[model samples]
Target: MPNRTAVHSELYSPDSADNPSLNGGRCRSCGYVFFPPQRYGCESCGAPPEKLEAVQLGGRGTLHSYATVHLHMGRDIEAPFTIGLIVLDDGPAISSTLANRTDEGLAIGDRMKSVLVTASTDQAGNEMVELRFAKAEGSK
Candidate 1:
């Protein structure tokens, strides 16, 4: 097996491909959960930065909305990709790139789950995996 690494090590775990989780922060005072793990302060309770603690948020969610991108100016990802707005089962809503290139068989209320997909290979022969959301099996 080739070497594998996460595209964003700060966002998700590089290991645990079978059960992926996002690096999220929770406020100890007010019990608010947020993604992207911020250390500034709790948005819900105005607690200090010390009140925030890192937590693992599950990668299961419901698709709230989605859009297909036909125009992109970034070199990281090509155009004709799909982005989905998912309301996570834990608490936060995150916008993740869909595994499918297009939104052919997607719906607003469909169940979605996180998946690791190969984005590119580095010069060192490491497979760079990116966390993406895909329509869950047997979900409508």
Candidate 2:
């Protein structure tokens, strides 16, 4: 669970799991998709801000890029972990952590799915939700 203020406004709520996925803004004028969902105006075609709509993103994506993090800035999550960018199947690319790391065989361009996880905790001890990418089951 995450407090409204504790959650990233640009991201959807992890708990909802229904409508709560990354919200993207699509320009009705040019069909441009904006990740982090634009609030006021469109960066492309100068579309009016009112023309943008909130679009729920698909949880499936391809592992665009990744790296094993030996260190991190936050204490809530353990270090020596893996993080990467997932280019959603129908949305913009987002940076997220890999669900499980096994020396077995993780590679780039692997297909993955989004899973909700605890990103960190607030000073008041509220858990912050985040999206993590995991290799799709049966993927090798």
Q: Which regions of candidate 2 fall more than 4 Å away from where they truly are?
A: 1-6, 16-20, 101-104, 119-127
lDDT of 1 by residue, 1-140 (tens): 78889989899976766549999999999999999898899999999999999999999999999999999999988989999999999999999999999999999999999988888899989898899998988896
Candidate 1: where is the Cα deviation over 4 Å? none
Question: Candidates' TM-scores?
Answer: 0.95, 0.75
Best by lDDT: 1
Q: Which candidate comes out best when scored by TM-score?
A: 1
The 10-residue segment with the lowest total lDDT in model 2? 1-10
In the range 1-140, model 2's lDDT, one tens digit per residue, is: 34533256466665653224667778888888767776787788887899888887877778877888776789867877787788887868878777875323677888888766666777997777666677877666
Q: Using alpha carbons, what is the TM-score of model 2?
A: 0.75
What RMSD does each model have against the real structure?
1.1, 3.6
